[model samples]
Target: MAEEVPNSSNTVPIVGPEFARPQPSDLTIIGDTVKDTDGNKVFKVKTPLFGLHNKRILVDSNDSPIVTMKMKVTSKHDRWQVYRGSDLDDKIFTVKRPSTVQLKTRVEVFLKQNQTREVSCDFTIKGRFMKRACRIYVGDSTKIIAQVHEGDDRLVATIYPNVDSAFIVTLIFIFDLINMAGTGI
Candidate 1:
């Protein structure tokens, strides 16, 4: 039988049994991030920009646009939305900071399919923007799907192979925005 545990709020029960972290071999991410200038940093993945927009895009090994991220200006939450393609309507998720008064950045992700403000988080990104560190978990579960750490000049992200690279990229971009906002730089 599967085990059912209550969530952080202790309101709704998490549906299924707990999941174990995937083995490193099971990870599909290339785990590469390189610098675009000076060659001081090494990136396992390549992020190349082609056009102009408030947002930026990153291409995969096939040169396909995998993730497009843009920040929203008018929202009180200071939101950033990540789409699967160039089209903003093809949204995968939105990351928003709680408010400006807090010290450590608190970001919540709401998937396009689950737009309810009251629903438990579809995925929660927890980390300190100042430290340039963060981890993305699968929904409310403790299973981490991706993570990022500070690098020489660039941020390094580790994405689980089974997860979408674009999704991971968006998470990293969200953290970058938080770092910029939190530091007031």
Candidate 2:
């Protein structure tokens, strides 16, 4: 009987590995920020030129994001970091480039710094190792943002979960409950 039963209309298939959307804001991430038409998961950051002269990038196709970066230091030493931050409404991943940092994506931005010194560039990654760094976070699940900072401390290549609530509800209410009830039929 259970095998012949039907699940509710709410039953949604377990899509793929789910993850929460990336939030704006990660530690002292300064400089400029702008939004595009999609409004989420597609954007860019302009950080003070840091690290090796060339860009070493990373990307996860499983995720839906790809970051291509090129930075150069002008004055002062502000460590570059990308992590999560709060915008009073939700959690956002931030890219902090303090002091003088000029940036440009496919859009524009509102600057927070009062300084006028930065090293910048317009670039695209064409290497395999670099291609591996700018990963993509796709679907409605959790994933880790692989990053490279200027320090002996490097986050191991691992996944940071982005848990989606609606997916969870569908799993519990539609699948779990229906399966349980059907088993007794």
Candidate 3:
């Protein structure tokens, strides 16, 4: 079964029958994974790439920088440090994968104000990255914000109306990075 996530920060508007499906006029975009099936990753000069070094940034269409995702390289626990841009200020949130062993993808999200390491998560992502399927949810994992479906050539993300689509795209990009990193989370 597929998962559905609703945007908590934004309210979806009533859609007409004409806009039932995404149209060309819609603000939708496509992203491609830059690696081959054999696990060989390569980056071309002109092709847009996701740079994950000391600072990670996703270069979207027209070679424009969309979001900058920062993460710690030598951390004992898996965590997405920060996300720049969007109305949520420069500090979007932090994603930390639990240390407990599990087969599926489960991570806890903490908002910018959440400095203390509390057991409660502001949001959570649950799904399987190997299948290219995942869902982002609000606190307590009830309300969903976005979802990413796996495709043969690319990952398809259906972002809800009134939500920051680019933010969802960035999350998908980060998922690809962590999944491709061979961390086995």
Model 3 scores what on Cα lDDT?
0.53
lDDT of 1 by residue, 1-185 (tens): 44223233322112111112232212222234433234432213333355433465655445556657677877777787777656777876777775666677667777877765627667777787468777777676776766777655546566553454445555666566666762211
Provide the clashing-pair count of each candidate structure.
10, 45, 4
Q: Residue 100 error for model 2, in Å? A: 13
TM-score of each: 0.65, 0.21, 0.64
Q: How many backbone clashes does candidate 1 have?
A: 10
Model 2 per-residue lDDT tens digits across residues 86-169: 122221111222323222211011112311232221111111221212221221112212221211222112212333322221
Ordered list by lDDT, greatest first: 1, 3, 2
| Alpha carbon lDDT at 182, candidate 1 | 28
- The order of the candidates by TM-score, greatest first, is 1, 3, 2
| Candidate achieving higher TM-score, 1 or 2 | 1
Candidate 2 positional error at 29, Å: 23
Q: RMSD to native for every prediction?
A: 8.3, 21.4, 8.1
User: Where in model 3 is the C-alpha error above 4 Å?
Assistant: 1-54, 60-64, 85-90, 182-185
Top model by lDDT, which number? 1
Q: lDDT values of the candidates?
A: 0.56, 0.22, 0.53
